[model samples]
Target: MKNFKEKFKLKLAENNYKFTRQREIIVETILENENWHFNAEDLFAAVKEKDSEIGMATIYRTLELLEKLDLIHILDFNDDSRVYELYLKDHHHHHLICKGCGKLVEFSDQGIDYFEKELEDKYDFSIDEHKLRFYGYCGDCRDK
Candidate 1:
């Protein structure tokens, strides 16, 4: 977490933004809940438990900054709201979303490299990144 904080501070400095206390609290909350797939509202709720003075505007702004700095990834599961995850390059994974209950599951990217390579060769294009999401009903919802 210290390493992430330092990197985030440096990135903020590079972008001419100050790493304020509110931002620090927000970042800390995010780092602490590394497995959480959250939106601004979710983040606001979590951050409020730590510092109630943090406003929704601040949360949104900090989220925007993090996304712009490539420190987080914004996921659009077509659910009318965005979710966020830390952008760990080495831990890249895709999502399996349950449309019935809005549950999100992360799955490994085992076979994706081969598919990406094939697509790159076929299209003669260099792929920098990709996002894959499969939406369906989870077991509980499917049985209903």
Candidate 2:
């Protein structure tokens, strides 16, 4: 796995974006929270825990920069709100979202590769990227 800070700096340089102290703090805060499926507000709260000077607008701006760099995935689950997750390059997975409790489970399926290949062969089209999200009641939510 690449060092998140180094990767962030490299990305910033590649895009001609300045690596500011606030951006550094934002990147570190997001990287430290591996399990967090966060929105900008969530990130702002976490950042405020360590540095009270940072503002929500700054957090949103930093998130937009990170998203443009493909360093994170921004998802809108048709709920009018967006969530973000770290983009771990090379470790691809899909989301199983619980409709009842709003929980997201990460999963991978071997059949997906076969299907993607078949689609490419049949349609003579190359698939660059795909997103799979299944929404249903999770076991815990179903039991509840």
Q: Please tell me which predicted candidate would have the highest lDDT against the true structure.
A: 1
TM-score of 1: 0.92
Residue range 1-144, candidate 2, lDDT tens digits: 248789989999998999998998888888777674788888898899989999988998899888899888898788867889988876788998888878888888989979999999999999999999999999998998
Each prediction's TM-score versus the true structure: 0.92, 0.92
Deviating ranges (above 4 Å) for candidate 2: none
On residues 27-65, what C-alpha lDDT tens digit does candidate 1 reach at each position?
A: 999988857588889899999999999999999999999
Q: List clashing residue pairs in candidate 2.
A: none
Clashes of each: 0, 0
Instruction: Compute the lDDT of residue 8 as modeled in candidate 2.
Output: 88
**RMSD for each model, in Å, please?**
1.4, 1.5
